[model samples]
Target: MRRSVLVAVMAIVSTVAAGCSSDPTDPAPTTSAASASPSGKPTDISFLVYGAPAEVKAYRSMVKQYDVDHPGVKVHLVEVSSADAALRRLRKGEVPDVFLMSRRDLGEIVDAGINQPIDELLDSRGVDFTDLYKRDSIRAFSHSDRLECMPYGISPMVMYYNTNLVDFSEMAEAGLDVPKNHATWTFDQFAEAARFGARRGAKGVYVDPSLSGLAPFVYSGGGSLFDDDRDPKRLDLASDGSLEALTTSLELLRKGAITPTPRELRSTSALDLFKAGKLAMMAGFRTLTPELRRTPGLSFDVMPMPALPDDRTLGDASGLCISAKAVNTSAAADFVVHAIGKDAVSDVAAAGYMVPANTEVAESDAFLQQDRMPAHAYVFNRSVKDIVTLPLIESWPALERAVHGDVYQLFYSRVIDIEALTKKIDEESKAVLSPPKASVTPSPSASASGKN
Candidate 1:
């Protein structure tokens, strides 16, 4: 259940997605500055984000428009498929002027010094910065203290179910009132119910490898990821509370509840399986929620991730950040600010995702005025308010690579003991962030990205 973060998987086909082609309602954008940046020159901003080339193409189009409208700014788009690739580029000084990345990736950049503080830029323009969603608007920078990044688009966790495979009537027969679409339920109850669906022959539920689907358990189970001050971002993984949270996922897998799929599918197309009616409950973020509605044969909607015994604080955090070395910092800032304001927020809401990150966007007619949201939408919102992004300290990426490599081994290999697994991970993390033992503590704060 510790396997969760504010960022979720979204395999949006850039060429066709709301990214590349501008919708009519989209605000007009061009790359021109009303005045010269203090730097006194047009900026050449290189933007990097994760996705296939198609997505990058869409970003390129928008960035190109930004460059054109702003006489002094030029933009470049760089695409990478995995978090590792992005890190490598940052380490090699091949970093772009600006970057578009997941919160997880931004955490890595924050330590690398690849991220530039944005306050000065905002101060320069005298922009008040009050129009954004409070959660995304503030926590993004607050998560790491010192305001490291901003949120561009956000997708919250959602519960996706395949009604065809699940017989809601069984609950009625058992005197259990099964919740209808968009209805909320507790984690314990949901697990019990998923077992019900499993007994009836449907894959009761699935948790893809991505963090989006797992963090809810931590919050709902009364587990806290870290102590008050996030100095040593400790692993509450084995906490008794988290153990209870972990049991939910463990139960689903042990009961033969879900058909195993490759992690790549979880990242790229797990929704396709849910749409195929292969699952009763598929935990995912908003990006995967709409397919349940769009698919003719599937009846499903969004729901909260679920609550554990007395647990309540769900991990959630998202924000957009401009690259420190961005050739066009001012122009990039404009795009990010605008994207956070209205246009991009609308796209996110219209796509059936969570409320927009912009305060106005969330309250707009498009958000508040909508009715009959997919199942789980409201519950999901309840958790979204208290979201905690994974700590993005300097060693996080290295720590992530180590944990990712080890967790799969432990899950699949029976020979490894839990103690041994934890030991291996702890040692790796400590080594990566070597504490100050009279000079042994290698600063997790490595040089800024693009410095090579």
Candidate 2:
């Protein structure tokens, strides 16, 4: 359901965008002016990245290569585990020349007003936007016609099923064939499969209590989390289609189809449960592919998450942003371009840790080839067009927490009342979206005058 943004969980930067061109054909990269120092003067620029030790090491290695190409520039590598932490560093006046982060963090970053628009910088460097590998990736990171960041990954949610546990036998018995492909599965058919598998003693599904997990369900039911995406004051979770979707999902838990109720799985992860062979199916992003590959004796494969007729899959992206306050803006811009360049993308794709934002790397045989279980590695890329972008708003984090918190409370309590729960969530969300009261207890002079 929800992919952990944490470095260790998926070994990917949190967030993703819609999929791009089906054609993986490599194209010539945009020519950018070299980071040649006219004076041949040495410069030190800071680069901030998130993830585990391995990711940090890999970035350092990549930077070393960049240094060789641009001898006058030196990159000081800084590591942090999450976006909030990076923002904290920025608040403390430790702004990096460039920093890699999730697109979801853009709202907060914009609020902090520390990032510079990349258009002027890109133009100055002669990097044609069209020449970039993934056009959709770039579009996903842009807001209000402003190119705020350069994308690095296009992570989309997909379904992972334990081949050994899913009810293939029951499918045959019921004269119901298992979906031949990701696109073939429907919500009704999916439910039938889950019900059949549950009867055969398999736990049907489990999802995290996060926006990523809930968004698909809402969209499938012809509802959205926001009433009006452009208006930060509008959150529309408690409604018709979303209500129906929420009801159906909760009923599965009540019927013992989905295991480890939200409360029960407080500490245990859905991924761990699936890897241990206890789950029949669960939803996750592409990074799950690598983790599932490394686990022993797990016969797992991925498919697109089953959806209703109107549903669109959720996709988010993350990339690099230059600090508006960066002292070495030119060098920072050059470093970001180099980091997501074609060669870097090839290495990233080969590692199988993430789907590269570069179209060439993502579509290339190296990324498409599967020595791993999910023979349908292309599902992530193929599902790009169907992606539903979460609204960009400063209050998104608050709204997400509000929605998830109330939903889980209802799920664990076995309330099974969709209308009531939705109403409650709607009420709470309204409070978040509403402007704060002015808190006027009369001016101090007025108060004194009135008292007298």
Q: Estimate the TM-score of every prediction.
A: 0.69, 0.84
lDDT of 2 at 267: 66
For TM-score, the strongest prediction is 2
Error of 2 at 166 (Å): 2.2
lDDT of candidates 1 onward, in order: 0.53, 0.67
**Candidate 1, residues 259-322: lDDT per residue as tens digits?**
4445435554545656766567776665454445567756775556655654243333344566
lDDT against true structure, model 2: 0.67
lDDT of 1 at 36: 59
Task: Identify the runs in model 2 with alpha carbons over 4 angstroms from their true place.
Answer: 1-41, 124-128, 131-136, 167-174, 199-201, 262-268, 440-452
- lDDT by residue for model 2 over 1-452, one digit each (tens)? 11112112111111221122222232222442244456666677899987545456678788888788777788888989866677678768787889887777776676677788775555444444554444556666665456677778887787778877775665777697577656647777777666654535557777666666778877876878767655545556677777777676656645545566554466667777778886778888776777788899988766676777664688757778999989777678777767776776666566665677776678877677766668778887876656676656655667677677776765566544667767777777766666467786788888888884
Predicted structure 1: lDDT: 0.53
Measured by lDDT, the strongest candidate is: 2
Model 1, C-alpha of 102: deviation from truth (Å): 1.9
